[model samples]
Target: MDASVRLHLLKSCISYATHDHVRKSGHRASMPPKALLLTSQPSLRNVVSRAWRAATSITPYQTSCFKPNKNWTLRSIDHGARPYSAKTKPTVSAVLKNIKDHTAENIVSIFHSRSNNPYHNLAIENYLLRNSHAQSKILLFYTNRPCVVIGRNQNPWLECNIAKIQEGLPWNAADWDDGVLDNDRHVIAEERDGYNVSLDLVRRRSGGGTVIHDVGNLNFSFIVPNDKDFTRDKHAELIVRALMAPMTVTRFRDHVLYDNVHVNQRHDIVMTCANVDGGNTQKEFKVSGSAFKLTRGRALHHGTILHSSPNINRQVFVAGDEGGQVAASVFSALLSSPAKPFLEAKGVGSVRSPVHNLFDVTDQVQRREVVRSLRKEIGQLFMDVNGMGDISVEEVGDEDCAVDMNGEIYRDAQELMTDDWRFCQTPTFEYRSEDAGGALKMRFQVKHGLIQNASLEHVELDAEQQLKFAGLEGKKLHEIQSWTSCLPPHAGFRHAKACAHLETVFPKIQPAGAAREGGAESTIIQEADLSGSNQDGIAVKRKAPGGRIELERGGENVVVER
Candidate 1:
């Protein structure tokens, strides 16, 4: 008669029906709707409707039970719910269980991460490497947002343009627009700002050259047992086969040549094509770069596939003999350009090669289609190579997925995001810079991203100035908020010029908010000085708000202004 009493009765009836159904069918019904009888009372009907909906909507794989609080309201108990958060997503344990179940000996498991966070994706890959069954083979595919990923043993400063990476790449709206007829460019413009989209710097637990990742690229990692038969080029060759597969598009069919694509001596996937000038000359372009990580019993071989990177040259073919100069992506060339001459780094350096996007060769192949083709092709190849059958494939990450922040995967991601891992992990290096006027020369010996030694020459310093110069030692290069702050206040014209040179050569790292706010005022210096001598033997010039300064070799003197 009363609401509470009726609620109890309704719950009992549902429970009894559920148990009876399990007894008869050997499986629990998701919700025994048939056991629910129509109730005329308004108060009881609302409770019954809520309980029934909640129970029925639960997935078959999920087990839920109805529980009543003191308020007489019903709540469905979720066994998979994580203690850290109440969101309805798969728990870390559940996901790990799923992975463990599929990863048996002789099994090939394919996991595609939906998260664009490089740290998260890489952490998931690492988990599979360490946690999955040792004998099982794993293929993980993921794409990250714009980020420059350096190898574990590589120097970030030597491998990438840290300033550019910190400032972020420009957002090109047209490049990202899906060609849906109903899409509005204005709405897209409103949604995104066409300014500096800052890229995250990630240091992966792998040993190889640095690489740039953007939405236009796809990353694949293969985790196989560390057996004697394993080779670095094995998976790389599989990628080549996938790339050489016949394209459905007739227009680009001729472009996909088998001999044109193969793994080189460097274990990199490269594509060779005829010069667009109709000459007999051929051009080679690197489409993918490989990196490997080895554990005691497992080996991880991962690489990138440049499909339709917007940062690259839009023109499919260049006009003249200079056609070979086109890079795979602007970011790849600019960001990964050697920071030599200025920085004598100790870690691994990227081998400079002309890179080309696969889209250019295939006439803008769809990224999704490329991923699908690669997955299918690689799955079959893996099975055939391992002499296995019936591989398991599934997508692993999602927006709603519950991530255990305290777990090993989260810790791994956090470690990758730390400043120590990003900067301090860099090998020993020396940075030498001289003012355009030749009045000031500075050399810094950096180890573990800290200035172990600082030398300032060609400039006279007073007691305070000398102290400031000495202070530069033991300071972290990345932690310096402003380069000018490191110089003595009103020390001299020479100091001012040296400050400008240092600022121009090595832009101080700024927070994302500060970078966005002050980016407009930031000076853009040509990278020619950092890379070394200019081929044309021309003067390198830098423009500031006050005046322009030109750097030239020979007897030419630098022109400076107040």
Candidate 2:
């Protein structure tokens, strides 16, 4: 991303947000993913031309999602992020108006997400809010391919598994991943200079910690005007109530580590919560994390409900090893602690990430089928809450609602994807590594995604050598990982090794809090049998430096398993 290149892209990619006053047709070209968008935007002509030439000779990969049917019709059903020709289908407005005409008071809108691209999806979410009137509330059901999304104000480097994200960085496989699931994207990504996956770390315009979404996981968001209570706790409870799950609704507490992760068999989100008692509340863990964004008089309270775990979960580290220990402990505690509607099903896939990111009982295909069933249940729940005994479901192509005539959507998405928003918002913290595992001690200050000050220390380094690491003051962490080739040519081999190692471990962002100080101190429990490990009530705890720093936001804390 060069300055000029990013600018050119921003100027070229149209924003999907459109004004209702300017009514326009909602038809988009069939998504070969890259072909139509590239062809439409002049700047992408060269890239697409080169890509097509290269891709034409390189046989196309048929992605499972893109498996097209020759007999497909405009009325064909689209289950996941697939596209179909809809030229013959009725317009989105025509169908939406039909629903609106029949329904009254608390008019609810439902949409199925068809884009695996988080940027595109997030943009669409905003579009719903930005385009709709205050009279109606919107519910969007979406399943992402594989993407890590963080809150608006949080730091990406602090919240994400940056090391893994960096390893799969430059995902230029648009030509390969086109609506078709062959092994091409995997082959091209893996063999294209040693990257295994093409990844994007997205930031949402809401307040919450990190969340990872994949096809196995189904996400729903609600956008409503501010006519009633808009408190954060109520938002969390609303989701719990709607889903008809027994998981208690809670908030963050003082002296508690704000590991703002969703509490599940595998804790991966951060939130503040506690169970109510006689004027007292039991320590609460997070299952669903809700963040809010107030635009005009309306507020968008969107949250994630963990359904199935994805394989990437094993590689990500929220609080590194400690997060895992806490999740296992909480899950074990919940088994006998009288929490109703436990996700445990004896032999089905459990909700933890590290345990089984992949499907165990069935393949991803079957798992997705389960997700579809879950979506219907969610829809029924939505209707129940809104006092609607009956409601109609509309299935339309995302392109039907997506409008990118001017790339405003791209500009907004580009801003969200920048290094500044991702890492710069991280709270100032110090890192002191121990010699126990070839760790390096360091203190850092990053703002606007740029390193203002950084100092690293290794046992072998002298005072001068210690300061050598300070030469990287102005570099960004994302850029630092790729700087291996640019190490000082004149530096001694030993010095080069240290710098390289420094770069490798530099972004291992740890919590700065020392309160409660260790894993399982906040809560005690066992690794539940949910993950199919079949070992019931195994005590889960571990010791880590900085004691898995606990944070308190408003009132909730997210503790992870070690």
The CA root-mean-square deviation of candidate 2, after full C-alpha superposition on the true structure, stands at 20.1
- lDDT of model 2 at position 408: 45
> Which candidate tops TM-score?
1
lDDT of 2 at 58: 26
Candidate 1: C-alpha RMSD after superposition: 19.2
TM-score of 1: 0.66
lDDT of 2 by residue, 1-562 (tens): 1234323322322221111112222422112222111122344544443444343222233212221122111122223433222222333534433433522333786666555556656766776676565667777766654556767665443444444543333232332233212211111211122223434567778765566665545677777776766555544555544333322112112222222323333323334333322324434434454567888887887766654444422332122233342322211221111101111111111232322221121243445444555455666677777777654454434333323322444455555556555566554433333331343344444545565444454334554454354555456655664435433433323445545555544433322111211122334323331122222211224222312211111222212111
- Please state the error at residue 145 of candidate 1 in Å: 1.6
Off by over 4 Å in 1: 1-93, 97-101, 173-193, 247-259, 275-280, 314-329, 336-339, 361-365, 398-406, 434-436, 458-468, 489-493, 510-562
Against the hidden reference, what TM-scores do the models get? 0.66, 0.51
**lDDT (Cα) of model 1:** 0.59
lDDT of 1 by residue, 205-286 (tens): 9988878777667899999898996899999998887776564224345433323688999999988777643656687888
